[model samples]
Target chain A: MNKPSVFDDFYSVIPAGGIGSRLWPLSRADAPKFLHDLTGSGKTLLRDTWDRLVPLSGVDRIMVVTGRAHRAAVEEQLPDLLDPNVVLESEPKDSSAAIGLAAAILLRREPNVIVGSFAADHVIKDMRGFRRAVAEGVAAARAGYIATIGITPTDPAIGFGYIQCGDPLSIAGAPNAVTVRSFVEKPDLETAERYLAGGDHLWNGGMFIAKADVLLEQLGKAEPALLAGLTELAEAWDTPRRGAVVDRVWPGLTKVAIDYTVAEPAAAAGKLVVIPGDFDWDDVGDFASIAKLHSGGRKSDLAILGENARVLADASTGVVISQSGRLISLIGVTDIVVVDTPDALLVTTTANAQRVKSVVDALKLSGRDDVL
Target chain B: MNKPSVFDDFYSVIPAGGIGSRLWPLSRADAPKFLHDLTGSGKTLLRDTWDRLVPLSGVDRIMVVTGRAHRAAVEEQLPDLLDPNVVLESEPKDSSAAIGLAAAILLRREPNVIVGSFAADHVIKDMRGFRRAVAEGVAAARAGYIATIGITPTDPAIGFGYIQCGDPLSIAGAPNAVTVRSFVEKPDLETAERYLAGGDHLWNGGMFIAKADVLLEQLGKAEPALLAGLTELAEAWDTPRRGAVVDRVWPGLTKVAIDYTVAEPAAAAGKLVVIPGDFDWDDVGDFASIAKLHSGGRKSDLAILGENARVLADASTGVVISQSGRLISLIGVTDIVVVDTPDALLVTTTANAQRVKSVVDALKLSGRDDVL
Candidate 1:
């Protein structure tokens, strides 16, 4: 008999739908973060995510769950994406509905298949390390445990949640797997510093892996109504009635993230495991994150990203994303963030990057939806 | 006999040629600062200068000396400006060549005309006080002295040159006129503070008034070659050979400022008078001046200037000049200056406003003159 591949029957599901308001004027309502090449890799984040998972799940086993508005863009970015493997949400019903529906559909196609949910707008530098962690997480999933790839904390980052690990799990092919003690929300600076020093807490990057049936079972245990609704939609997803069913059911689905619906409850029940991922990862959360990702920790460096971006910087250190094809000139500005798009521009300091969302909120309040 | 207006025989000469590089992106080589409406008023600075001088020098007596490249724009801005009164230089030959040529031309047109050289880009908030100061300076000019309106020092501003005054002049309708001991260069901060404290110094605002013959005489004494070249151009100005003479003599003319060619030498000769201008005046030299001009001394106020500029600023104190019709959003930034044009954008602190010229220089060095 031929030896089986480690990624046998593994499926990758990408949930790509977030405006990423902190990255405003670049990531708009029609074009979200996943549609952008934030890493200067000459590929959209969604395309990068698809490429990252192709080695493990193969091209045919990958599925994308995104807003109906972004269907054409996602397809354009990932032309190899199959018609049947794409799930379009009529509207945003949160991560629970998006992930659970994908899981239910995958289970219907093959009950024993393993499904891994990965965000479409994240950046992972070390592909070898990322693949190794995913393989270990898949091994844990095959052992009847919902697995999460917890990133090793490199700094005291208060922007992300923490995953606390307990005793180690000795699953076959997954020696680094450990029982997840709990899933904690984003902590304060002191708590984050303690978490970084403790060595038992890893950043919760929201990469979840599990058997299709196992994820559905965990969803059922946590929110039965949400699971039932997702199951109903999944049954009709492969049929011509997919449109009618989604339009009728998506708006009424529960709005909750997978961390609350599955990871938190599964951890409480001792059915979740965390595989340590020592790879570099980032959600591209804000300009500050982009600055850090591109600067390579050089505080005095200016990070500029765009295909036709013409930047002239002198004695300045900052992040400048120019999508407008205009020349961006910076002088003696330190730690500033300048995002120039076609219709809007954003200027702020890296320390106030998170407050960019308030600008979007104010725009929305003023009914300036054309730019948004 | 009919009573004469105070402005009778008084003509205004606007030397409008500097690129104002420190206000870059908004102020380009083709479209310099004088063409921009930096005050958020409905008129450009050149037009404002015309309006301000109309009450002192009637529309028929106001003359504009600018580069030939900007002749069309200057005419469009001031349609009431007579064609014969506008002197178009084939190339920039500095303030002395521009103002001296205009003086030589006015002397040829009418011998006794008292010509006042007012910068086309300075901001004067108090029109009454400005006219009062100009009338006093003109009175001193009628008394055969080269007269300049020295602005009252409001702060220890090192950005402006100081005009040291000595003894009072007894010219009628000009009680505030004093003998200019010397015209000093821009001083260091300590020297500027001492000049401010000594009460014997005033800011040399470059508002010089003199008879056309007197100005030409001073220019002949200081720079005879420049005066001779300007006199030749002026002799041919109203003839059909105007363009030929300008083309032949403009580039060969001396490149010097009026301060060096006339004011300083006249001060040394004990034939210069300084009229103390208590009006609020600003040269609009840089973004810091723009911030101070628009913010009205309110440190925390965000000053936005553009007709179609849609701005959303929160907890930000700075100046934003948006000419691109884009939505500019600022968050948690202090003392920042953002200039958004259609082809280029600039971001810097008000403290580094003067350094913006370095960015323009860099662009020029890189052969990006298309944007410049």
Candidate 2:
């Protein structure tokens, strides 16, 4: 099978560090979101993502970069990748700081090797399509380009920030690639609907592929001090106390998202390329978003038992995920969402789902880990 | 303290032998409604009634007349009442026949003693008031008259039939005595409201106190054959072959309520005397009525909790009776009745509480005795 491949010596650094609080109750600080079996089936999101990456590289070729807090979990999740090679951040830092560190560390060992970064907590249903995108990303990275797979808009999904692709990259027999125009922040309903209808904006899947050399050179050009510090730190990675050395050098690092640190600036530099991807993808942000991914809005519109029991059953109103232990009988509940964990239950309207974070915030302010 | 002593020389015979499909999922052939601990206070209605009657009578004076199927449970409930004298029924006979039998049998031992016949599944609050009423009933019976303590009307409670007192008996020094004008059938809300306003009508509390001689004489005047056969059987009650003899004689008895068979006729004949009872009482005919007895009313309610987790908040508009071992939370329910037993739960608006019998009818047709 003449499958397309990434740059010959590429490193896929999957970041699994973020202590995602938006998916609270189900996801906890001690056991983060990536570890949850959201599907109700046994496999976790990180496990699925790791399996997707395995065919492209060997044990040493793939490196996972996570927080020091998550190193043991990462080792346990991907046993084959557990070694001195895997990078654990000294202190919890922004994604770009970790990304820059991974790039600098990998470049020293395989100077020509490409770098691919992925968020660990994502669901990509179309693995074959994703594999093809990875192969395309590796090719682009070899050509000294920063490559990001932008998913074709399926809905006016406002949960994700979008990327606007400018023109198609024409290469016969190759998957259609595009030159990216500009990044778009997460939009309101009207803007998201316009992006969906306009057919240019794509969901930014947070999976980027670029060569280690290109990433370093760009960092040097864009943030020379940050690049210098990461390089110095990577040089002593295998020396005495690698993490301790990085911890000593970490205080001066800038705190910013990778999108803000590099992707936004690099896209403005005219070298950023976007490839059209047909993969069924999700970042799985919160309970509301995770619910959508679980059913995919494709089939299974949940209908609680009705009629015989007095209830306000208007389909347009809201979805209720209430405290119906083994069996939940919903009566007279209208336009509300109810989610029951073994402990606390969450009840609000779907219109207020995004603001459910405020509930968590209030709960945290009240010092209620028992609820959140 | 000279507390006016209320004597239960009167045997409290709860006639639960009839096939009560009206109380399905609770009153089954094997385990009737009287067997269930509906109070959720670790006491069955029969047991609660028995306890209530304890202050009034000796253990021998408390008999539960149930079917052959419920003998074991009845015995189990009152291990003390299992001394053969506490349970009496003619293998699931109708109330008329059971009452006929009750009168004849009790007369053999306590020939001139008053027997107060009551149902087991009724709920009574204001125990002090109930005790005073029972005392009034005992006093009225002592004066050579058949006495039935009638509850003063609080509303036009259409669920119960009513009695209109003609006038005071013109007796000197009688504080709460009345002559029976006639018994009224259950009426509509307008009629019931009027009855409450008139201050002369009483809800037939289904509690009757009369000398065994008076009850037998009334039975003789009405169903002479039933009364005569039962009298003949009464002489042979302590005989070894009593069950076989009862089987032979009981089939000849007609299926009629005691009110229709004797009480109404005697009242029509101007021989019935009424004594107004001051007691917080309920027949607990359905789950809805049963709930009100717990919560008091919608305005003033009570809660049932477990291990600090409140299981139910009972109200007049709605009541929740929970089975132990599960957490229950009810929201926004009004005028609804909820009975949660181990096997199944019943949820119905109390307005349709009379139609709750329809649910029982359906269960009976489906042959779901496990639920019952």
- The residue-by-residue lDDT of candidate 1 on A44-145, one tens digit each, is 999999999887888888999998899999999999999988888888988999999999999998989999999999999899999999999989999999
lDDT of 1: 0.90
The lDDT values for all models are 0.90, 0.67
The superposed Cα distance between candidate 1 and the true structure at residue B361, in angstroms, equals 2.5
Clashing pairs in 2: A6-A138, A321-A338, B25-B372, B27-B33, B156-B192, B298-B316, B317-B335
Judge candidate 1 at residue B120 and give its lDDT. 97
Model 2 over residues A1-372: C-alpha lDDT tens digits? 122343357677887877666665446666677886655446777887787776776556677877777778778888888586587776677877788888888888777878889888888877789878877877777676788888988889878889998877653323566788988888999999999999998999887788877776766677777777888888998688676767777778776678876777778887678877888888877655655654547333332321222222222223333223322223333343444444543434444456656556666786766554
Q: After superposition, how far is residue B160 of candidate 1 from its true place, in Å?
A: 1.9
For every prediction, compared with the true complex, DockQ reads 0.84, 0.06
Error of 2 at A279 (Å): 3.2
**Which stretches of candidate 1 lie above 4 Å from their native place?**
A1-5, A239-244, B1-9, B167-173
Give i-RMS (Å) per prediction: 0.6, 7.0
